[model samples]
Target: MSESTPSFVSLLWGTLFLRPYVFIFLAAYLCLATRHLGLGPTLLYLLLGYGIAWTSEFCSIHTGIPYGLYMYIPATHSQELWVLGVPLMDSLSYVFLSYASYSLALFLLAPLPRSPVSGHPVNTGRYNLATLLLAVVLFVTLDIIIDPLALRGYRWFLGQIYGYPEAGIYFGIPLSNFVGWFVVGLVMVAVLQRLSHWSVPFPWLSWGQSRSTNDGYLGAGLYLGILLFNLILTFYIGETLLGLVGLFIYLPFTTLAILVRCHPGFKAN
Candidate 1:
């Protein structure tokens, strides 16, 4: 490894040590994804997610296509690994975030059973247009909570890593940023939906048999975990107004989810 670039071992250790919370969420994703989607598909999602997210960031910084115009500060370049000016962890985050959102969408929209003996609540294992659209919305909603707080990363442990050229209407983040998230989320979830169909040959690579019926809950929980994590940080950093805005935005969705989850009619037979 060069002086500026750290070895994989060092990068992994540094990420684990510095961003343990990220790893916590990531570990949950790994277990839940491996169990429900099988190891092969889970690994493919990570690889594809990282590629798309990194490219989006790179493009946004240069041509301002998908995520609006923003630039990384490169303040952590020496301390952490950066791929072409974007932090490796920054792009890597989208993998879990997208998966969490996609899984939650499945939990909400799929024919979920309150209880099942042999399969997940989202037992259909099929993707439709509604699920795809809902997954995209859910994925973008995550950024609604995440990006605002992240913009103020200097106030917390995240540090000042990136910023927009101009101040945005909602918490200093531009509207185009969200539009960009929507586009990326749509593409990523759509890719995942396509991948869900392929059959893996290696039995050892598939975890479908050992998965719990409650695995869908775990997947949705990951989404909530990430949302709660950022909201808590927003409050912890004294951004009470911003945090409240996030709660207000999500309150209706949360209530809707609860109502849908509890309604006897919504539960599958």
Candidate 2:
């Protein structure tokens, strides 16, 4: 098929499969989630993430409450899947992104030493309020990189899918957009955590027996993967300043995850 006259099958394939970045992340999400949470939980997480993401986009566009006033640009109108004016791939992206964030939290907030009396890991305080703050911070940190580059979607693998009703200072994205991502990210993590909590005998449910090199840490590593992916795109598109800005947030977290993974003392403590 010619570039200008691509077939409908081509568009469907492009949205779900041929888009290299999105497809790769989707595969990574499945693999990591199944490795960590088993098949049942992984499936559940996928559904929940998609539902929440689509709902939030629908609500935000209609009421301008969560994500501020914005509308999809539909630059690829007939070339991608859309439901209620939101791209299917866009909502689907949240499944992997937020799962990785929540996994990073699980790695960082893993409880202290295992109990001698019982093989079970000790329950720390209520999700450790400290962890909650850090998780949300990390989740929001992702959007700092995401929203700006997405506004420059014309330059990257991402087509121009959406835009703000009013652009703000951060590379033509509104501040409210980032706030919405943070809120939505927090909600995603919290729901997944609750689900993990309910799933009996899951590895993370142990709370204290954290593996530095296991699935939790793998999720953390994926954050760096995402950072690198965007940085490459930023460089390719000549968004040097934006690339540097992403570096500022991602590098420190990368260092921290490395330390947490390599240092024996950091395991289960």
lDDT of each: 0.82, 0.75
TM-score per prediction, in order, is 0.89, 0.82
True lDDT of residue 86, candidate 2? 86
Q: Which candidate tops TM-score?
A: 1
Give the distance in Å from residue 236's predicted Cα in candidate 1 to where it truly belongs: 1.2
Task: Go through the candidates in order and give the C-alpha RMSD of each one to the true structure.
Answer: 3.1, 4.9
How would you encode candidate 1's per-residue C-alpha lDDT over 96-205 as one tens digit per residue?
99888888887776564534554445456447888888888989888998999889999999988899888999889999999999999989988888766668788766
Candidate 1 lDDT score at position 25: 79
| Residue 188 shift from truth in candidate 1, angstroms | 0.7
CA lDDT, candidate 2, residue 193: 70
Q: Which portions of model 1 miss their true places by more than 4 Å?
A: 1-8, 112-122, 208-214, 266-269
Q: Model 1, residue 18: displacement in angstroms?
A: 1.9
User: What C-alpha lDDT, on a 0 to 100 scale, does residue 268 get in candidate 2?
Assistant: 50
